[model samples]
Target chain A: MPSTEYRPPRPFSRIYVEDAARDHPETARVLRRFSRSRTVPISHYKDIFNRPRQEWRAQKESPALILAARHGEFLYDASAYTPTFGHKRFHYNALALNCVYDCAYCYLQGMFPSAHIVLFVNIEDYFAATEAALAEGPLYLALSYDTDLPALEHIIPYTRRWIEFTRTRPGLTVEIRTKSASFNRFADITPTDNAVLAWTLSPASVAARYEAKTPPPAQRLRAAAKALEAGWRVRLCIDPVLRVPGWENAYTALVDEIAEALDAGKLEDVSLGVFRINRDYLKHMKRRAAPTDVLYHPYEKRSALATYTAEEHKSMTSLLRSCFARHIPADRIHIV
Target chain B: MIILHTALAAEARPLIRRLGLKPGPGAPAPRLMVGDGTALVVSGTGRVRAAAAVAAAWTRLDATGHAPSAILNTGLCGAADSGRHPRGSVFVINACTDTTCGRRYYPDILLRHSLPEAGLHTFDKVIHSPEEARSGVRTAPELVDMEAAGVFEAGTLFLPASHVHALKIVGDALTDARFVTAADVESLIDDAIESITAFAAALRAFAASSEKSGRVLDESEERALGEAMDALRLTATQRARLSAAARHYRLLHDAPPSPVLAAFAARPPKSKNERAQALDRLLHALNGV
Candidate 1:
């Protein structure tokens, strides 16, 4: 086995600022926060973020910050991979492109060409669009679709800002899903009834092996317990459950831990999913990312999707649902 | 592979000597020096010359099937504030701009280095005084050069922006017009040689690691798989499917799936139907049936 040496996470040594976004308040805030970092100016974020031949692994090693004012589309219909939680009008936004945490199974590695975080500084435009979409009917918005907003709260309090935005909008329900234990970022603010603080919890073994730089399951559960105590609508996500060697035991232990740590009766719901990705994205990921067992699995290809065979998917999901059902009611378990 | 471009022979001499580079066969235009997995090109002092030399050197190396993984363009530069950025001080450029077109290129500096970071402006004409530097360069760059933009533009044509870099050693303050000699330029680069080589080594290692990670099959496994396809006389579609299956199997098992092809050695498939049936069995075996 290769020797495991601990290396600290790379710093965001450079911040690319768009010419038009230089005067934005959020831009100024980020610049002030990372004052010691080098600031490079560009006309658009795509110049750096969407460049071809960018080494995805290298950029992930030391991701830079690209702050640009978004001029075009802000909201998109949630992709098939995301579960809408039975919401009829579901939408997502790219307030930030790319994520800080580098999970091996993340589809962002294939969806995006670079790992540099491109933060849309013109957040008010996204709010305006969301409000416009809300005018049509009730909207279930996934705020952290492309990124983990809570993980980046220290850099820019986008999670807090989104929670604040959702407080007044009665017909809009937003889900800020994360693998972060950063509930303390917005601890002082009152929890909004419409905003859901969803945490994706994985087995400790899985977390340590596959999820790089993400908080462990115990820390996430502690954060969820704090949210539940503060009357926040906290949801537990056991999502993209990999079919590792001992997945059954790992997930059962995870469910038991979740039950012991927090009151499942007061929990909002449990989201369960098998590991599935776009077929093309999986190809791109295999071509770019390091060799890992998860990407090497012989998945069943159906059209543009790559996932486990139907029998395998059913077996994995059934095992988890059975394990989780003992703590949470069967009605509250959602599988996507 | 690593490729280093310098604007003058004086700038390249110290590096060639320090890195133990030898001259290429016969003579090449714009002077090419070679070492283990590294080559240096001494282009004359100008943007056009620098860009052309990089392209020519890259083409020659690529033709030999040893394309560079990283390109470093290092040479002497001028900084207006000499006290803050004194002569002989080196900097890793974070961004470079072309004053002629007002176009800027930002090289992703992902590696860790102790040298100070600075933005560079590539000018068409030399800056004789600080007044000209202030008027012409709008980005307030700390270092001024003549080939950074050209080098970046050419290097990025073949490699990613992350793999392209520019290191500048301050040769003088912006006040001097023609005072610095070739010896002075050589000394400046020689002083910062360690940092330059260290950065280059880091880039090469990073690229090598990435290449290793992205590789689905080793050379021997690839050869074995290729020979199996020829033996099977598979169609184009079948060849593609078999190749994908072999890669998937190798990724899972850490060994090539070509050994399974030995079953057909005694009685090779004779018809299209037989080949299809054999391929299905082979794929099923590779997929862990």
Candidate 2:
């Protein structure tokens, strides 16, 4: 039998201590998981989490009761910022971090120090914080941008809480996004008009390669179908279209399957984008990724975004927009 | 192609038959490239053996000067939780964990989220309950196979940054002499073959690009990696600590620890039987589980 050896914990960007007043008491609770290991000489760590920047003051920083944060109570700002496309005018909140699935191409590779998940149970506090920050009415919030809130329903049931919280405020609309097939968790919940569910999907081929930790694409679609039937508004996100030899056919097949699963008339929206990362994250990506040319291409610098060249971005986005529009209204489409 | 990790040769004979080939007489030195790109090497279920097995596989590829895009550690992992777990379910691991101690790993391909996450972890011990399995998950390992981490490390020896795609099937969770049954073993093996076969095919089919990068040990790349480490604020002390850790890895790669090798060399195999046994052991260890 092989002996178990210690592998150094991956690098961390920053750490936040859960102050007594914070929203999520659970954030600090999970960080101490290793405290028991301190008794062993080899297991002791200098600091449970890296606290490089408690206050850079240059970077936008906030610390509350982080219920649970991915990658050691650290969240990357500007690592990802999506502009709501179509009828959804909202921003995604990665307040809780890391999904239950460990997909190969997941952006978490560059975002976290460890794979252990951290959820900020004080999510309601984040909602309160969001409400306080938003002077506008009816602002849509993406709940599971960095993690799957619904999948954890079997465990943490955070998404259920979010739904209840959203139901209280008519001005607050939520979009619970997921790639999980754990649809049974929400099979019985009555849908709220203010709550929109966006399912991030990839082609079967993509699932076979990079989506190893994810439920099969069809399973996710089946979940989406159930949600739509339960009277939930659904959006299809095929962003980060990974480049494979036959991406055209693969995406076509994905859309076809999704279209089959959901009555196209009830399909709320669809958004798609080619895979691209900001240049800063490109550094982190290089350190931990597998062999692939899809990510290493020279990106174009546009509006401080490192992505495909103008023509490539425009054409690709336009192509995807049309591909998605073929199944849903163009007004319902959003590019994130 | 299917990957097998059982130590039982008599049972393995049936697998060989399924592949329409006879089991090689008495476990010959684990062959490389026996079935083209799909090679079978014994990765005895543990960390050290798995690492060694991985290294041996790399040595074969290293001699040819070609590296495989994927390295998989296929095996049976036991835990006493059949009531909760369907026997044949397959999982690809995210970390190789030592559940006895809570050591965990973040594989080269880091999952964006935690569930929907499948990874094979090489563990020295077996977990016997849903609670034990949950603890394994809490340790941050998705799948608890025996040897993928070592195999991944061995691949790292050659590529220094190769990623291992590992998977495991549930075998006997806790099979005692009386508790163990051929029916149990066959069920696990069948599930293993199906899952591994699907896993290999899935990798081939799912060609995807996420913005993942591999840093070469080369100077420029090293600087980039170092800068990333710095951005992550690996404290200067931490940097030095990592340096010391890197030193050990370097020593292992370029040179074998002398005293141990000398002892093995001194007692070289004298007969073909001894050689075969020695080679099998070495080959098995090469898998590094």
Please name the candidate that would achieve the greatest lDDT relative to the true structure: 1
Write candidate 2's Cα lDDT for A39-156 as tens digits.
1111112122222211111011111112332323222222344655432345657655555665655666556533434455555557666666456655677778777777666545
Show how many residue pairs clash in every candidate, following the order shown: 0, 60
Lowest-scoring 10 consecutive residues by lDDT in candidate 2 chain B?
A: B207-216
Q: lDDT tens string, model 1, A35-59?
A: 9888888878888988888878777
Candidate 1, residue A87: the lDDT equals 91
True contacts kept of 2: 0.07
Q: Which segments of model 1 are wrong by more than 4 Å?
A: A1-9, A135-137, A246-253, A325-329, B227-231, B250-278
Interface RMSD for candidates 1 onward, in order: 6.3, 18.5
**Model 2 / residue B207 / CA error / Å:** 29
lDDT of 1 at B143: 85
* Candidate 1 displacement at residue A256 in angstroms: 4.0
Query: Residue A225 in model 1: shift from native, Å?
Result: 3.5
The TM-scores, chain A only, for the candidates as listed are 0.96, 0.75
Q: In model 1, what are the clashing residue pairs, if there are any?
A: none
Clashes of 1: 0
Error of 1 at A140 (Å): 2.1
